[model samples]
Target: MYAAVVRSYQESPKFEAIDLPEPSGAHDAVVDVLAAGLHPRVRSQADGSHYASRGELPLVPGIDGVGRLPDGRTVYFAAPDTAFGSMAERTVIDVRLSVPLPEGADPVQIAAAMNPAMSSWVALRRRIAFRPGQSVLVLGATGNSGQMAVRIAKLLGAGRVIGAGRDPERLRALRAIGADETVSLAGDPETAARRVGEAAAEVDVVLDYLWGKPAELAMVPLLKRRSDRSRALTWIQIGSVAGPEAAVPSAALRSANFRLLGSGQGSVTTAGYMAELPALVDAIADGRLSVNAVPVPLADVADVWGTPAGAGQRIVFVPTRGAGA
Candidate 1:
């Protein structure tokens, strides 16, 4: 079988012929790869930068993808952190982690949207007790997952959604996709913080993707502007795109009724993620949650590995079929 093999953390994944691993676990089965997304998570996995990376080399880099099982069912499956990922003609998958796609669901679209969409979808559903009509603020709202967070918050019944990002054009574009208001995080820090405070001071929830200095700085101003400091504010750390560590203000935590927590692999259990998958899959399949995606041949993985996808467009790799057929 052929796969995008990563031999070093410093180099791009090359499409090369490799032997497929036989299933060893009770739930494991080799499935035909249909579409795999080139997500930031996948990039980090390939480069050995993700916290989950075990520094293992000579591996295939893909977290999750759409695949066809031996039983002929098309399902979306999440791959374990093994040498053989879902980037090949065939890869091992835990059958229990997969869910069958609804009739007429587009595999490419599902591949492109699921991972990014899952970040916010799972966070809102499993991380917090979110209710309809509550206001939301999405930090780093210009990125792929952040953009989806804006829409998901609205779909989940957020009364008002505020989007803040460093891209002025992208921030402006957020209003069309259910953001009640948008703030530009570009330019002078003081000015940007003030705008964020004014726009999202009273929001009930914040889905923060930028956690470094940007998130650290935004907190104080946002907390100060709140009309009622005693009101509950839930801040869910979804991604650390800006930076990992933040010198959080001790005063900020003590000043208001602020509750901070993370939402990801360890934070949300496997059962928790599985429980939310069905509803989320149905939403993406039915077009309730939409994403812009483009399909590229898996053979071109190495060439496009370092290239960034166009604004708001995710790249989904389509491997040549029949190898696993």
Candidate 2:
């Protein structure tokens, strides 16, 4: 079988011939990899940069993908924490961790949207007690997952959704997709913070993807502008695209009713993720959640390894051409 093999942490995965995958677990089955997304998480895993990476080499670099079982059933499967990932012609999938897709489902779309959409979906559903009609502010809303966050917040019943990001064009585009308002995090820090504060001062929840200086800078201004500082504010940290560490001010906590927490692998249980997959898949399949997916042949993994997906675009690797169509 041919797979994108990553032999070094410093280099991109190379398309090469590899041994066929075999089922190792009792519930595992070897499935034909149809479509796999080249998500940021996959890049981190390939380079051994993700927190979960054990520095394993000579591995494939896909986290999740759409695959076909032996019985010709299509399913969305999350790759195990092993070297055998979904970026291959075939990979082992544990049936327990896989969700059978409905017939006629678009595999490329599911493969593209699932991982990124799951970030915001699980954060809103499992991470917090989010209520309908609550206001939400998505920091770093220009990126793929962040853009989905804006849409997901609205689908889940956010009365008002404000998207904040550095890209003015993307920020402007966000409003058409459900963002009630948009704020640019460009130019000077003070000016950006003031804009964020003005737009999102009374939001009930903040889906913060940018957690470095941007998050720190926006904190005080947002809190200060709130009509009632004591109002409950839940800040769910989904991604750290800006940076991992933020010098959260002592006053940011002491001054307002602010709650800070993270939502991801360790925070969300395996069962939690599995439970949400069916609904999320259905949403994407039924067009409740829309995504822009560019299908590229898996053989081109090395050539486009570091290229960023276009604005609001997700690149999906098609290992089996037309198999997932």
> lDDT per prediction?
0.91, 0.91
Clashes of 2: 0
Task: Give the best candidate by TM-score.
Answer: 1
lDDT of 1 by residue, 1-325 (tens): 7889999899999988888988999999989889999999999999998888888779998999999999899999989758778899889999889999999999999999999999999999999999999999999999999999999999999999999999888888999999998889998877888889888999999999999978888899999999999999999998999899988899889999999999998899988888888898899999998788899989888899899999999999999854333
| Candidate 1 residue pairs in backbone clash | none
Candidate 2: segments with Cα more than 4 A from true spot: 321-325
Query: Could you list the CA RMSD of all candidates, in the order they appear?
Result: 1.6, 2.2
- TM-score per model over all chains: 0.98, 0.97
Error of 1 at 189 (Å): 1.9
How would you encode candidate 2's per-residue C-alpha lDDT over 6-97 as one tens digit per residue?
Answer: 99999989988888666778998999898999999999999888999978779898999999999999999999888889999889988899
Local error of candidate 2 at 254, Å?
1.2
